[model samples]
Target chain A: MYTRTLFIDGQEDYPLTNRKEVARLAGVSEATVSRVLNGIGPMKDSTKKRVLDAAKQLNYELNAVASSFARGRSGNLGVVMPHVPKVHLFSTYYFSELLSGIGEAVRSKGYGLLLLFRDPAAEFDYVSLYRTQRVDACLILGASAIDSEIAGIHRLAEASLPFCVMDQRFEHSGLSIVAADHEQGSYDAVRHLIDGGCTRIGFLNGSPQYSNSQDRHEGYLRALAEAGIEPDESIFYEGNYSRTSGRRAAEAVYRDLGRLDAIFVGNDRMAIGLMQALREKGCRLPDDLKIVAYDDSDAASFTEPPLTTVKVPFYDMGRLAADKLLARLTDKDQTDGVINEKLQTELKIRKSSGN
Target chain B: MYTRTLFIDGQEDYPLTNRKEVARLAGVSEATVSRVLNGIGPMKDSTKKRVLDAAKQLNYELNAVASSFARGRSGNLGVVMPHVPKVHLFSTYYFSELLSGIGEAVRSKGYGLLLLFRDPAAEFDYVSLYRTQRVDACLILGASAIDSEIAGIHRLAEASLPFCVMDQRFEHSGLSIVAADHEQGSYDAVRHLIDGGCTRIGFLNGSPQYSNSQDRHEGYLRALAEAGIEPDESIFYEGNYSRTSGRRAAEAVYRDLGRLDAIFVGNDRMAIGLMQALREKGCRLPDDLKIVAYDDSDAASFTEPPLTTVKVPFYDMGRLAADKLLARLTDKDQTDGVINEKLQTELKIRKSSGN
Candidate 1:
């Protein structure tokens, strides 16, 4: 079904400037030349070698950009992240793990990764990436359900773009999401603290803008309700999931230290900070105030008392997001519905939780 | 100067299938159309608006891939990192900080970041990235001076490609290198320990394959010589820059704890591990084992006793590498000679060094 462009050897009407010239010299069909050059379909070794040799003789370099445009594929996957000034996203265990997973998957598939950062406060056109044909598919990370963020998600969904949000969720049914069950993870951690003879337990949470943080908060309340323990607002502290914030939260909770027996922290970064701050204040871990945190990051095992935490499997979530997006890109017909994959989180019992 | 393809209305000889058609319809020179469409060079707003409006009227969507091929610039930078299975490179504080700097610089330049990973143990051609015209420039990260790795560096140098090695030094003068002064940083750390009344201090270093490790080891020896103390090889432990290795090193030194008054760790990851392991064994920090570590990472300040460490400006190094590469790409004539920039490191005195 390919149209052959005639390139007569001595005719002035036809110029020897296209793939047809290579095909003619190689004594192969134009389709074979296209397939061999693009590495798209299966081809015999002899035929492929002949086509390559012909192109080499003509010194015909393949224009990858032209070929990509003709094939309607960019061979690149886009990863959009939030850009916060002075805050190095890579320094955080959360983002680095997700990116590693995405990078691994994209590399294995022979695709390039195009990383772009979007300022959360600035107005941006996320769909312009696909409209400009810069990426075949996209994966969004660190997205909150803010007005602009949610609008961007809806735009992607309406455009029918192949994308998956890593560790972020929304109310839209058409959106694809890959995240850990933070609520259940949080519940399990709190329940573990209660089972360890802990009453009047405090909870340190991140910002409520993130769905995971909201879910974790809900889980904390649910676990407390189940144990017939009345929740006290005074013992709950809100942090921004940063070490600095964790230290500040520890300071805030120190006033009520006499009333608290245990505490559940949002993430390992904050947990590590809290532990250090409490230690500096002469509070003994597991003896004065036991602690349970989430995202059993690398720092968790090496913390002072080896933190007990919820292993959120961030790397797996990243891999699964890329896999799902790639699967959709490869098989559009079969993978039409919105796929929401929530990986399970395991509670690792370490010494810090009085285990 | 621009070539204008001839076309006749209602003539079967000419096909309206190229950028020439868009140029002709825009009533502007082909150069202006090319410049406006590619977003290159300054242009009058009225002229740009006219050209864009004309393109829209003609239903012409700019094929960026084809345009990139025609212009001979991809507007992308390639970042090649080492790929280790099951090991997330981003989870480490070292890489994340470097990447954050690189990302910030790359974004400010309006260029896309193309990330790729190469297996350290495998033989691969690094020049293929430039040969394929996939990136305008390249940056090599996490590279050691192994035979193949060194050969790849030479290949890029010989090819005269605009590239820089982040935090890796080579014997060749033709290479562009950006790294921290690890030797001086290590010397300062050890000297600080000695000044703090430490007589017999241990050294826990990473693998010798990395140049930083070798520099750190030299600094350790130099500091001991300056202090008029004989170096004891028996107290030296080799690690792989991991917390697990640090923990093991601590275990090995536990038997000789009575003989040692202080320890110098290569990086914070290993130092944190060492402290945790020693603390588990009933050794009090500072009082029992005064420790000095490298890389004042976020975890360092939040460690149990708030580790005292040498601050290697990884973010600044990354930014400098990117900035150097970008400068060469922009002004090749002025930036011809190889540039080697070594940023100074500072010792952050905290509680861990008994300060």
Candidate 2:
């Protein structure tokens, strides 16, 4: 009720200042401010000028949120992530990093971050984080989590909240995305290894469910095929980008260790773990077996022999996503269907790859 | 009136499933369901049992948010991040890492993430994000963009929202924080270098204005003092936690190459830059000069010879801060002032430090 009376008469927007406050500041009557705003029986044009000028100087954005609230449309961002067990928690740095970028992007444009972690709740109750008037937008990361909560998210989207996905390309969905050129990065990493005299190379792949993982795996396989080296199934092992998984992959290679001279890991986390396992097994880097990794994470430089890795353009992806979201929020008619941009990755050649 | 009737009947905590739906499910009349909820018009206990059973089967948490909206409070986490220029707009790692921990912690407890970036809007105007009525708590990351905006945050805190700062300890009134044990991390880095045949160690520090940076510097000095080695003022260079600063610090060391045997960099970003500069200047890890860094970031392990750095418990800090915030939210009587927990940092030894 108070907010209604505070609105400027005949104005579609909220008042820059309440009548009582404006009257006190400009030494004018509340009735006069109302008359000036409504254009009803205005005194002098100069007096009206005084009130209008004061409102302009206040620089109010006209309580768009309040009006939205009245319409049951809350402007917020719903971030849904997998609530994995503790051992698998830190292993999901990719999720964390991407969310951070998304959070930064949306918040800069004056939106909110609504985080949802899926756990074992009663059927259909888990995805309720997006059901209420909490977020106006959603950024879903990784496809597996989306699968589990697709129904709930669909309900939210139907309620007019814009939703997007990162790092994955869905065939049927119209969700926007900002992803790295993981395939190119993988290609470059393998090529670097080949150029450095690595004849027999091994591949440690991430989970096949994630599209990015699949893309990286394809790149690795293609690079091997193009180089006229028959892809070795024994040389390939699937990992989930965790240190333990990387270590296991290394152990799998060590079980039949004579032929491989280099290894290409799916991510830096697993690469570090693989390197650690290799070091423990008395293998020297670049001398016995060289290593290359994707994601060029902070831990890559701290491995026993620094790894050669591909650097994801996280910073650029983050900024681009934010800019895109801001552009979407500001322009109503700009529903240019899901703009998919792939930023380039840099191949950082370190000592592990014999560079 | 419906909510009021439910409250009068002591069924306010029960969620809103239409009486008709309950009746249809329970094979009862709408009046019977209402009588069961209201406890006024006589209804059999069996009928009440059926209605209560139906409500439980629906798996609903009473929409406390809708009620809170009526009371003018939004239950959301207000996250504050500095908008750093010349850097990737999105902090792929920072947000990903922090939110993974925080998102998991706040997931079931029902507080959503309310991310707000500190835009360069004359500092005072940055607080306008809170005017949207979407945030109930605040999570402030340590950075400069939001440094000048703390006053606005303070104003937000006064408006009855809880705020928490991470990776920083501010002396500001009414601020709660969870900071890393940078001092311990620095101590470990310097001690490791000393143990590795380094008598003259150089320090590449972050900005002194940052409380964490200052703590690290003090720790470096303390380690030197403990070893009866007077710190060489010329060897200590102030740098931002960036690669450019690392390169600058490396250059300074290279100008007087023989004076220093080891260098300790502040963060992994700068450490990579410093290592690049050292490598360019024909410096070999542990052979020409030993290197140790703080934060033990993903990129650190991938440097030329790999870095030996101290690990900052960043993820742990995020979890602890969230737990603290949640504890406060659940029990208002848990106000025991700022609970300062200094998580331990491990010194990860690698080839760069002659490991």
In TM-score terms, which candidate is top? 1
DockQ of 2: 0.19
lDDT of each residue in B194-239, candidate 2, tens digit only:
8777889988888876778888988998898899998888888878
Clashing pairs for predicted structure model 1, backbone only: none
DockQ of each: 0.31, 0.19
Off by more than 4 A, model 1: A1-55, A332-335, B1-55, B255-259, B332-335
Docking outcome class, model 1 = acceptable
Q: Can you write out model 1's per-residue Cα lDDT over B1-355, one digit (the tens) per residue?
A: 0111111111122222555777888788876775566443335658878888887787675545545544555678888888878778888988899999999998777677888777676544565565455677888898997887887788778777778888878887678888899999999999999999898999999988889999999999999999899999999999999888998998887988988999999999999888888988999888998999999987787677889999999999998889778877778484677878999999999999998
Q: What is the TM-score of candidate 2?
A: 0.74
**Predicted candidate 1 versus true structure: per-residue lDDT over A1-355, tens digit per residue:** 1111111111122222467888999999876775566443235658878998998898674544445544556778989888888889988989998998898888787678888877676434555566555678889999997887887788788777778888878887788899899999999999999998888999999988899999999899999999999999989999999888998988887888899999999999888888888888999887989999999888787677889999988888898888778878778584677878999999999999987
| lDDT of candidate 2 over A40-62, digit per residue (tens) | 22146478678767655653222
| lDDT of model 2 at position B297 | 63
Alpha-carbon shift of residue A297 in model 2 (angstroms):
4.2
Model 2 Cα displacement at B103 (Å)? 2.9
